[model samples]
Target chain A: MRSHPHHHPAPDLLLAYAAGSLNEGASLLVATHLALCPHCRAEVTRLEEIGGALLEGTEQVAVGDDLLAGVLARLDEPARPLIRMPDVTPRPPPAGMPLLPQPLRSYIGGDLDRVRWRLTIPGLHEAAVPCRGGSVKMMRIRAGMGMPRHTHNGDELTLVLAGGFSDADGHYLRGDFAATDPSIDHRPVADADGDCICIAFTDAPLRLTGRFLRWLNPILRT
Target chain B: MADTTEVDRLNGLLLCVARQRDRQAFVALFNHFAPRLKSFLLRGGMDAGAAEETIQDVMVTVWRRAGDFDPSLAAASTWIFAIARNRRIDRLRRDRRPAFDPDDPALVPDPVDGAMEMMLVEERAALLHRAIRELPAEQAELLRMAYFEDKAHSAIAQERHLPLGTVKSRLRLALARLRKAMSGDTLGEQA
Candidate 1:
């Protein structure tokens, strides 16, 4: 596989990839990488086999004899519209924007008008990235505003749109990605002045810090 | 073995439920993986309610993206753990929680330490569980503390109240044993 020397999935991502937990957008990104990076793919495959062996070793959890019947009954029941698969197309960049990454472009199919402007932090502004797949949002941290130091509840893939940010690991610019392991700590502050917009795909709500800041998080939710 | 087959079949069924937007399948999947996922969160230091809420949200995600599962690439449990891991990290970042760096010298996996690694591999749901199960108990315990708990040699030493040098030596021996084990070589043959 051809490696993009410039991009590499974080180790945590590799583990997640091995485990099969990444969401569609991020998963697609890693899948694309696996297509290109044979080493990573090999690691993924080994992890899968290892994971399989582990599952095989686990003591089986006893289930009621009716569990299959229960599942089948559930399957037979009427389906709901609660979960909708969004059309996987890319939104258009603002006028005159340079070509976007394939992963980013796939989700932004030529629509820039519908993105609702939400709020702006010092150098960043949050906007709802419209999608048929539940609530998804896009955050644009001005070259300088980036993001405040933070952590997450689950996996987050911060895809850079333009400009960059720096954490302890090094600088991440346009098209550079960062996958935080659940165990590792980080403090990512955006570029000095230019803006870096990131598409943050998350399954849960953000939990901001401190009593005052925590209370304000609700207001910040779009 | 029957249970394994059953779980695999249930996974297939769950996929179908997810694709069809079957709320019950969604709930079933939630109920199955939620507790395990919450344990993962609690181990990572989340309070009970927060862990429960995190589990609920992750299930909601499983409900939403059931169609996304690609059977060719991973099993249901692996896929679920991947989702759980991501959600856990995202929550931590949003809350500005500190991350644990595995590369810190303090956090480094001793190349010779197979004991803890072996034991962790034995833990169910870990991809390498069985491989580790074949190891002797002493080696397995050390690997478990090192790999599963993300502990440094010093920490392990402190926990066991052993001399730091002794801890280091054991870790080194453990890693050597694990490398041999992974390569399909026996410790007896090596000795």
Candidate 2:
């Protein structure tokens, strides 16, 4: 496992994970961290069980007469099929690029057709994936291409899948997850010769600050 | 009063509401959590109107994201509180870069002073409360101070006239004990 000296998950996040407050994408990142950190995962499991017990014990209030009817009507609504996106395959891994991490295989996939490419920045390409809850996405950054300097408008969690990246904080490689608070502002540069893939989730859109890309903020949906 | 078993059963009902888009369940959840969420925001310094608006947004998010709720992980109130906290922090960060205009009446409104009614619909809250009450008095006191007063460890230590490390050690021990008690484990050892 790749290690960063300061890569501990925050208490709030552990609490949120236990509480199930995180979105699907963010939850996956936390889950990955929990898998690596047994102590934290144990705490999460304990908290969740406590929450489940608490929920189980809650009292029910009288429902408005029409509420059930409205719910039944919506239940009958047809399921929406997964929306497929146009595909963009990364160049075949150079003769000896390391295999993608096991956790990421289901997401990145063996066939290019299964993956959906959403938007392409100079070094990054993001795509949304169908999951149990809602859509989750992966952003792939080509080697040497760094993301433009930007700060988050809300909590942003990223889990590295392939290659590596380093910011002012430290190096992050496969299986390493980083959660950045809104106060943190830095640019992440991909390793010189290896592409980096990460799964990230954010509530507010990213505010990019590069001189030429400032105008594109409205268009970049993170 | 809600029974613990009844609350657990409601999870299945909630799951149905969430998966099947049951409006009643959504409404029930909103009625239960919205006001409390509003009060939580008010504590964070938002005006009543903003707090109400934020609650509405959080409830709507709950409606849209209910399927994401994994009963295996948390109780509904805890989950709802987390969302409220996230939304409030998001708003605070958004307003951070802008200058605060002290003269603007809209921005300077006094904080709301009412407490949210603790009509917990979940019977488990009572059990949890009881478990907390059953803890060693010192541990219980520490937990209460942490949650109710929302004070930092240093403050808690200073107020209690305890060493800083002693305070942290006590808090950790207390939480561990609470976890065991809530989990139905007999206290076999003390940290």
Best by DockQ: 1
lDDT of 1 by residue, B29-148 (tens): 655665556556665457776766666556656655678776554567656655565566556533111122222222212234324222222222221343457666766565444432
Encode model 2's per-residue lDDT on A36-65: one tens digit a residue.
443554566455444433332333333345
Q: Relative to the unseen true structure, what is the C-alpha lDDT of residue A75 in candidate 1, on a scale of 0 to 100?
A: 43
Q: What is the lDDT of residue B115 in candidate 1?
A: 40
How close is every model to the real structure, measured as TM-score?
0.41, 0.45
Interface Cα RMSD for candidate 2? 16.1
Task: Give the TM-score of chain A, superposed on the true chain A, for all candidates in the order listed.
Answer: 0.56, 0.65
Could you tell me the lDDT of residue A213 within candidate 1? 55
CA lDDT scores, all candidates in order: 0.51, 0.55
State the lDDT at A33 in candidate 1: 43
